[model samples]
Structure formats: structure tokens, C-alpha cells
Target: MNVAHFEGAGAPPRKRPWTAPGALVVRALGNAAAAAPVEGAMLRFGRGRPGDPGKPVDVTVGVDDTKVSRQHGLLVHRSGWWHLSNTGRLPIEVGNHVLQPNGDAVPLRAGVTSALISTADRRHLVELCVNGSEGASPAPAFGLHTAPGHVWRLDERERLVLAVLGQEYLRNNPRAQPLARHQAAAQLAELRPGEDWDVRKMDRVVEAVRLRLSGQGVFGLVQSDLPQPIGNLLSHNLLTELAVTTSSLTSADLMRLEGAD
Candidate 1:
């Protein structure tokens, strides 16, 4: 059952499928050939050894890329899948998509996905491969935490809209990029072919989402806040205190939204 987050709306939380992978292989793509198995669920990448051994990041890059940060990025292991989150000084680009510093992560799809870490100091190319993930794919789940005691859940449409915008924000200009808004409208249109959609309509939906957040006593999303919550979202950076990032997207959510399931 779909529970709208309009007024007083909620449903029980869902537990998505979580599968453990056999291993993650990271390869340095340069001069010769070198490979390593990411030890645990979390891997941290960078040039030198981590200053603090207690830090939980799991991967390290042994390359000539001096520009790479000690804590460049991370491949965090979730319940069922692995997601790439940028934690470095530079952006992490994967599959032609770029993630800003501390930007939203992308789920690891099948096959090898390489990310380019570009910096004036050093440029490095690394590829990630998920070896032998075993289990049934889980349903996609979206959620939000507005206030300390309040929570909001996104319906399929809302989830899809935010996801499209989030990814677009990462791909283009986070601040001035119009791709997110325009592309989101296109995505929403694909979801509901019976209705007509324009940029203005999509704006209305976004405004409505903000209103819902404000109505729930969340102050950061309404009117004009210094951080500009909507602007940040438009840039694909999630309101960690309020919304979930695109990395949380599930195959089931995609299928149902596209009417594929």
C-alpha cells in the first residue's frame, strides 16, 4: 500500500533485501597491472596510509596519483548492496557521472564501474567490481527524517522525482544546472503518461514537498533558509537530517515506478 506524505500519512517501515558479496576487487588502471581485494564491507581510498589507523575506511590506493587524498572516497557496504560515496577533496566520476565532495553515492551495478579522480596534482583511474553477490534483489525504499521526533515517507512518484534530480545535480552544475529540473519533469512525465507535465508543474510539486516538510515542523525547508534546502536538493545533496540519498534506491522501486513489475 502506498502511503502519501501529505498530511498525517505513514506506514510501517520496510526491510529491503540485503545480500553479502563474496568480495570487491579494486584495480589500478595505469602503467602495469595491480589488484587487491577490499578487506571488509567498508573501503577507503587515497594515496598514503591513513593518518589514523582507527578510521573505518577499508580501501587504499597504491598509485602515483599524488593528488588523491588519504581519505579520497568510500565504498560503503549496506545491507544488500555497496554504494560509492565521495569523501575526497575532489569529485568522483563514475559511468560518466560525477559525485561532489561528500555527495550522494551510486549503487554498484553489475560489471566493472570505474571512477576518475581528477585533480591538478594527480589523476587516477580505479575500477570497482562486485564479485558474486548472492540473494534476491530487494524492493527500493525511500524515507525522510524531518524533525527529531517526526518522519516523512516518500511515495513512488516523490522518490523517483528526487532521485532523478539528485543524479542530475551530480551530473551537471549543482548550483546552476537546469538539467535536474528539466530532466525530472521528463522522468515524471514518463511515469504518468496520461497527464501533461511542464517545468511549472514540476515546480509546483517541489513547492508542495517543501510545504509538507514545513507543515511537519521542519524549519530548514520552508521559505528562504541560508543553506537553501531546496537548492541543495536541486544540487543532488541530500538534507541528511530530512531526506535519503539516491544511493538508497532499490530495484523494486525502479520497476514499480516504470510499471515493469
Candidate 2:
């Protein structure tokens, strides 16, 4: 008796076969919650269909989402760091950095990093966690009076300006966003009417902080590191870093501004 056979045909595949014990873990957030380990040097992500035999991606991000390309992007382990590279038409937001399609790879710092993949209708979040590994450094410390050691010090004026700019986050606003330059300036003026505070001064002060932080290895502070129409990208990134990594800004800061004449 002769048995028909196919070259690649085999037993049913194991669930999340790509996953294994490794230093890097990539898990999709939300209902799908598909996860895989970066056992190899690289892992690809893209749109995946429910029951397609073909290997769409190592990790599935969106199903039947036209916006997500078949081979959207990848996570590559190189030089002891997992860097995210976007290969699709749309951009991928990883923490404060937005990785544009075909753009340069951005290193993912140690610990949990949130990456957002947006489709036509909704947004899909993928969490990339890099466990302790060689050459992997902890996220930078930019907090005042909170960090255990090695804090990114800010002058009095810089601290005040940042506090005003990040008041929304300090207030625990769910829809928090960095305040506009003019708005922040206005608040600072109200907070200290004697001192000169305007758009120009606000820009200078914020720029100084951004430059200092960027020089200290913080990502997403420089214009070239972000896309155009930056809007609040600089302030947003700075404030986010401050909000998460430090107690540099707090509700009391906001109360001070509000209570001011």
C-alpha cells in the first residue's frame, strides 16, 4: 500500500509554538491575549486570520484588519537589547517613541514596554517585557525626591515649568495630555505674576529640560526622534517620564497654581 504525503505536512502545531523560556516575552493585550517568547533572535508580528494554515506571523496582532499588513514588523534581539522595527505602512507607538514604517530600529528598555498597533476601527496593544539580560540597563531615573539613586536633577524653574506642563497627569486625569505652551505659560504667569512668563520663555525652559534629559539617554525628547506636527510630543514624553519614574510633579503643584492669583 502506498501512502500520500506532503513535504511540509505534519502533526497539529502546538499552541504558541514559538514561545519558550527566554529573556524576552511578547504578549498581546485584550481578549486575544496571544503570547509568545522570543526564543530566537527575531520574532515577526502582523495581522493573522483565525484558521489560516499559512504562517501569517509568529505573533498575531490583528485579525482580518486590513490596516495591519501580513508582515507588519518585528522584534529583534541584538546587542543584548530587543529593538522594535516597523515594516508596515502604519506607525507603531512604543512607549513615547513612535516607530514609523521602515524607520530605524528603536531599542526597548528593560521591563514592560507598551506598543500600540492601530487599525481602522480600533487599537491593539502588545506588551513586550524584557527580563534581566546582559547589557540590558534599567529604565532611566528622572524623579525628584523619589528615586532611590542617581536622579536626574532639575533646577527650581525647570521643576516649576514641568509641574505646570504635567499638571493633568499629576491630577490623575484619565485623558491626561501635556498642556500647550501658551497654556503652561499662562499658568506660570498666574503662579508668579512678577516673573516674566510667556510663550518664548516657556519654549526655552521646556527645551532646556528636554535637551538635558535627551543628553542623559532619554528617548523621544528630540524633534528628530519624533514625527512631524509634534504638537505635544516633547512635553508629552517628558511629562510621561516624570509621571511614571518620579514624584517630581504632584497634585499639590497643581493646587499651588490654582490657588495663585
Using TM-score, give the best candidate's number.
2
lDDT of each: 0.51, 0.66
Q: Compared with the true structure, what per-residue lDDT tens digits does model 2 show for residues 153-212?
A: 777788788888888888876456888778889988988899999989988988888898
Indicate the TM-score of model 2: 0.53
C-alpha positional error of residue 11 in candidate 2 after TM-score superposition, expressed in Å? 24
Q: Write the per-residue lDDT of candidate 1 for residues 47-117, one digit (tens) a residue.
A: 64433564422344534666677778777655445678887788887754568897777666544567778
Cα lDDT of candidate 1 equals: 0.51
Model 1, runs deviating above 4 Å: 1-22, 29-40, 49-62, 132-261
Q: Estimated TM-score per prediction?
A: 0.40, 0.53
Tell me the TM-score of model 1.
0.40
